[model samples]
Target: MSTIVFLHAHPDDEASQTAGTMRLAADAGHRVVCVYATNGDHGTLPTDLAEEETIVLRRRAEAEASGQVLGTARVAWLDYADSGMTGWDQNGHEESFHAADLDEAAGRLAAILDEEDADVVVGYDWHGGYGHPDHVKVHHVARRAVELAARRPRYLEATMNRDHLRRIFRAGVEAGLFPEDEGFDPDRPADDGNPIGTPEAELHWHVDVRPVLASKRAALACHASQEDVGWMLGMPEDQYAMAFGDEWLSEPGRPEGIEDGLPF
Candidate 1:
C-alpha cells in the first residue's frame, strides 16, 4: 500500500482541510501520516485546560487525539513555536516557524518524507490558504522539502474552492440561516492579504469525502482549544456536511480541472 503524508501549519489545520482526505486514503488501505509544522504554542487559551497543561502541551495532545480519529498511523511535529497571525509580535521570534531557516526547516520535513517514503505529499495552497505566517511558511518549506527529499511523491496543495464557499455563504444568507459571518469576507483579503482561496476555475481535484465526513468532524472536535473550530463543530449536521463534505485540492503549478483521486 502507498503511504501519504500531510504537512500542516498547526494542530487543527489537519482536521479542517485534510482529515477527510486522509481518512479516505486510510480506508483504502493506504498508510497515512501527519506532520505538523509547529507546536501550536500560540493557540487560543482554553478555559477548560488543566492548570498544569500549557498551550503547547494541550495542543499536541489534541493533535494526537485528532490523528487517532482520522485513522492516521503516525503524527509528528516539527517542534517550532507557532508564528502568531500575520502581524502578531511572535512572528519575529527566532523560534517561531515564520523565522526558522528555510533549508533547516525543509531538511527536517524532508527527513520525514524520506522516512515515510511518501507516495503522495499534501501541503497548503500558495498563500497558505489564508496567509498566516506559519501557513505561508508551510508552503515555502514544503516546497523546499519536495526538492530535498529523495522520494518523489505526487504533491497536492490543499485548498478551498473560493467560488464554492461563496455559493454556500450566499445560499445560507438567502435562507437567513447564516448571517454574514462578522469579519469574514470571502472576497476581502485574508491574513495574507490574499482572497480566501483559489477560484473554482483553478481548482484541480474535488475529492468527495462525504462518506468520511463524520471522521473529519470528529478530528476537528478534538481541538476544542480553538473557538473557530468549536464554532465550526456547532453547525447542524447536514449543514456541516454541506460545508465540509468535499475536500478541494490543487497541484503546485497546475492550472485546474477535474481529477478524481490522488495519484496512485
Candidate 2:
C-alpha cells in the first residue's frame, strides 16, 4: 500500500486545502497521514488564556474528527505556536513558529516520514502559499524529509494557478463577497492574497477532486473556529463544490509513473 503524508501549517489546513484528495486516497486503501506544523493557538481568542486554551483543545478535537472524516490513519503535530502573517507583531515573537529551530523541525518531520515510509509527501509552495512563516517552514521541512529519508519520497507542494485564483477572486467580487479595493500587492507580498497562498503553474500538479467535494466541505465544517462559515453562505452549494473540486500538487523531482490523473 502506498503511504501519503500531508504537511500543513495548522489544524484546519488539511481539511480546507486537500480533504477531498485525502479522502479519495484513503478510500482507495492508501495509508494517509497529516502532519500539522502548529497547534494553531494564535488564530483567535475570547480575551482569556483559559478560554484560548479551551479553543485550542476544541480545535484539536475538531482536527481529529475531520481526520476521521477524511479517513486519515494518523495526525501529528510539531507543537509550535501560530505565527500570524508577515506584518503582525506575533511574527517576531520568540515563541512563534518563526523562531523555532528549522533544522530541528526538519529533523522531526524527517523522522515521521522515515517511520511512515511515505511514498508521497505534500506541503505548501516555496512562497509558503502567502509567505506565512510556518507554512514556509513546512515547505522547508518537507523538502528536508525527502532528502533525509533512506528511500526517496516524492515531495508534492500544494498550490493554485494564476487563472484559477483570478476567477475565484473575480467571482467573489462579482458576488459582492470581496471589496473592489482588494487587489494584489507586490511590495507587501503576504498582503496580496488568500490566507494560504496562490498557485504557480511551474510548481504545481493539478488534480480534479470533484467526486469527493462533499467530503471536503464536511471536513472544512469540522474546523469551525478557523473558517468563517459566513464566507461560504453567499456562494451556492454547486458553485462551492465546483470551485473547490480541484487540488494541486508539486514535487521537487517529479516521481516516475505518477501520471496526471485522478489520484484515486
Candidate 3:
C-alpha cells in the first residue's frame, strides 16, 4: 500500500538498474513511479528513424515502453539534456543535467515525491556504479530530494554486487556461457577508472528477483537505443536470468544494512 519512486539519470537507467525491483514492487500491489532526470538526448539514435524523428522523442517512447514492461504506475521526465560521459564535449553543455544546480534539481524530484506521496525513494550509488557524471549527480540529487521532501520515506540506493559480478563472469567463462572472445574483464575499471559496483560487504540487501526475472529482461529490451544495455538484451533467457536474478541496494549513511530490498 506504499508508493515507491525511482529517480534515475536517463531513460534506460530504470531498466538497467532496477526493473526487477520495480516489477516486484508493482506485483506486490505497491504504487511504483519513475522519474528520469534527462530525456536521454545523447543516447544512440536508432538507424530507422524517420526524417522528422529525433533521439529525444525516440528515447522518450523507449522509456515509456520500458515503464510498461516494468509495471510502473507512472513515468515522468525532468526534461534536462543528457550530460554525456565524463569528458565528452556534451558534458559542458549549458542544458546538461550536470550543469544544473543541485538544489534546483533536487527540488524537482522532491516535487514528484510529494505529488506521488512516495513512501520509498531509490537512486544510484555514490560512484553511480560506474561514475558517469549525470549518474553521480543522481546520487547527490536524490539525497538532497530526501531533505526537500516532507515524507520520511525509506531512502535506498541501487548498486551492483561487484564481488558477485566477478564470480559470475569467471563462472560464465569456465562454463563457456559466453563466446570466448567476449574480452569482458570484470576487474577492469569502468568509466571512472574505478571497479564497478560496491563490495558485497557494503550492500544492505540482495533481492532475489528470479521470480520476476522475465519481466526484468523484457523491460531491458525496451531500451533499444542504449548500446551498453544491448549485451544484456542479446543474452539468452537462462543466462540473463542467471546474471540478473538478483538486485542489490544499500541504505544511505548506514554502514550496516537496515534490512533487505527496499527495507520493506
Q: How do the candidates rank by TM-score, highest first?
A: 1, 3, 2
TM-scores for all predictions? 0.94, 0.83, 0.94
lDDT of 2: 0.75
| Candidate models: Cα lDDT each | 0.87, 0.75, 0.86
Per-residue alpha-carbon lDDT of candidate 3 for residues 39-112, written as tens digits (9 for 90 to 100)? 88888878888789998888889888988988898998777999999999888888899988999999999999
Q: Which consecutive 10 residues in model 3 have the weakest lDDT in total?
A: 255-264
For model 1, residues 1-264, the per-residue Cα lDDT tens digits are 888888999999999898989998888899999999999888798888787888888899999999999889999989999989988899999999999999999999999999988888888888988888998898898888988999777888898889988888777777766776644568888987889988988888888888888899999999988988978999998778778888888886776476877444
Candidate 2: count of backbone clashes, pairs at least 3 residues apart or interchain = 3
Error of 3 at 166 (Å): 1.0
Flag regions of model 2 displaced more than 4 Å: 46-53, 168-189, 192-200, 227-230, 255-260
Best by lDDT: 1
- Among residues 3 or more apart in sequence or in different chains, the pairs in candidate 3 whose N, CA or C atoms overlap within 3 Å are none
For candidate 2, the per-residue lDDT at 8 reads 89
Order candidates by lDDT, high to low.
Answer: 1, 3, 2
For model 3, what is the error of residue 2's alpha carbon versus the real structure, in angstroms, after optimal superposition?
A: 1.0
